[model samples]
Target: MKSSMATPVTVSDITENPHKYQFKQINDMTGQSILNSFDAVFISNSVAFNGGLNVLKDSIYHETINKDMRYNINIIKTAKKNENNKELKKLVKLFHSKEIQEYVGKKFDHKKVEVKKQVSYLK
Candidate 1:
């Protein structure tokens, strides 16, 4: 019989979670540089493997396909701009609220009538 659910935790799953996974600062820089150098070497080797310098004359094309990648940058930018405008409007309304205006000695108007603050009596 097959198991209903496999083990929830996996090594790859743990590595991908930013909150749980962290790289050492030293290792991050050094490892990245090493990886970059290796990538450069690989590129050099790949070119050398396929007829050294003659591959460029044929106009050979090499494409790296990333099926998982999707970009909606325009949508994100538009959404942010819209949200910021909404937040600004909310702030303006908050500052214009009755309690806030009173603190700043500002008066409210309605029907060409101004409401005056009632004087507090001391007992």
Candidate 2:
């Protein structure tokens, strides 16, 4: 009952029926970060594994939400001035390639994704 679902705001908002909150015991749900909140990424048991971490039956869960609180995000970015940079373009293409997407899915438990870039430099 101590996950994000039971945070002050959630509990206060649903005082009468707070028990209805899905994660109230041995929760793998996420909560606020120690130093970051806005746009912060919190991975739940369901996010990093198939069928949620509940069935992992591995000690990895000990390092997950219920035990530790650490989160990180990687944002790939290119400056506007690099619009026509061939090397950067190639790198981005490689990143969104099917092979890389599959690697990401296997390692991160995320779905395949593609990025399409449209150039309007003439505008």
Q: Considering every candidate listed, which one attains the maximal lDDT?
A: 2
Candidate 1 lands at a TM-score of 0.19
* Whole-model lDDT values for every prediction: 0.33, 0.44
- Model 2: how far residue 78 lies from native, Å: 1.5
- lDDT by residue (1-123, candidate 2, tens digit) is 243524433333444554553422222244322213433233444443443333234223334222123222223568899978999889988987889888977775553223343332211
Clashing pairs in 1: none
Cα deviation of 96, candidate 1, in Å: 0.9
After superposition on all CA atoms, how large is the RMSD of candidate 1? 25.2
Off by over 4 Å in 2: 1-75, 109-123
RMSD of each: 25.2, 12.1
Q: 1-123 in candidate 1: lDDT tens per residue?
A: 111124422233433454553432232224323543442221221233232322223223422222211120111123445756876667656755777666544221210111222122110
Best by TM-score: 2
Model 1 residue 68 distance off true place after TM-score fit, in angstroms: 61
